[model samples]
Target: MTTPDTQSCTACQDLERGREQAAAVRDRSKVTDFHVLIARHRARHPAADEAVNVMREQGPRT
Candidate 1:
């Protein structure tokens, strides 16, 4: 399940997909790039950052 904000955020979806693809292929550089992009996104969107922190606290979804 995705939050309403996440579902509506194309940039977030794209970055996550890019990161997943990079990780699947063991492309550390691309993965790092996506992480950087996500960090930048979070810096600009405090709500998103907070959501991520909450999710982290909850741990991984099963």
Candidate 2:
């Protein structure tokens, strides 16, 4: 059963993966594309997006 939490987690994981791959190849265009996608996702799910933005601002946890 795919719940909202799972769906949100998957979206976050996919975006993070895309970001890492883009960075690995130093592909500016792809990175920009991912940024666009992320923005759309944030618009669609502002609450979930807030959690992500907070984590991003705080940096990775140790």
- Backbone clashes in model 2, listed as residue pairs: none
Clash count, predicted structure 1: 0
Please, what are the lDDT tens digits per residue for candidate 1 over residues 1-62?
A: 64566666789889999999999999999999999998898576657667768889889776
**Candidate 1 local lDDT, residue 46:** 57
Question: By TM-score, who's the top model here?
Answer: 1
TM-score of each: 0.63, 0.58
Number of clashing residue pairs, candidate 2: 0
Question: Which candidate gets the maximum lDDT versus the true structure?
Answer: 1
TM-score of 2: 0.58
**lDDT of model number 2:** 0.76
Pairs in clash, predicted candidate 1: none
lDDT of each: 0.84, 0.76
